[model samples]
Target: MSLPDELYNAKFAEYIDSMKIMYLVDDRFKMICDDYCISKVNAEKFRQKIERDFQHQLKHENLSKELEEEILIYIMKNI
Candidate 1:
């Protein structure tokens, strides 16, 4: 199944915004994009990989749901 460009772009923007906020909070917080040294193309598989990796790290860190959601919302609003 293929995803439309609009959906991909929106999700990519959201992911980038979220990552920027995460970076601001923790300079050590690394993303797959950084690790792979690859450009973001907004592909569905790439999006899923990013989301999965982020969620895994968040879970491992035991970060609070409220804090995560707040950061995400703040990023969405401000960026």
Candidate 2:
């Protein structure tokens, strides 16, 4: 039988942090572009790509639903 290593969680936490930051940046960038009247090619496709990435991160990172909700709330509040 093998036991989980406590220290291993630190790396996973960092990965989650990175994913959260990327999601935040992507969301903010899209809003900023909209405000600036910047037209992107195939913008819906790009949005879908980012959405898929964020969903994958949430699922694979194993972050709690509450935490994910809070992160999104924070982003919405600030931007």
TM-scores of the models, in the given order?
0.27, 0.28
Model 2, runs deviating above 4 Å: 1-41, 63-79
List the global CA lDDT of all models. 0.60, 0.58
Tell me the alpha-carbon RMSD of every candidate: 22.1, 24.5
Local accuracy of candidate 2 as per-residue lDDT tens digits, 1-79: 1112321245556665454455456767435534433334356568989999999998867767778998999999999
Candidate 2 lDDT: 0.58
Model 2: how far is 27 from its true place, Å?
Answer: 35
Location of the lowest summed lDDT over 10 successive residues in candidate 2? 1-10
4 in model 2: Cα distance from truth in Å?
Answer: 56
Worst 10 residues of 1 by lDDT: 1-10
Q: What lDDT score goes with residue 75 in model 2?
A: 100
The all-Cα superposition gives candidate 2 an RMSD in Å to the true structure of 24.5
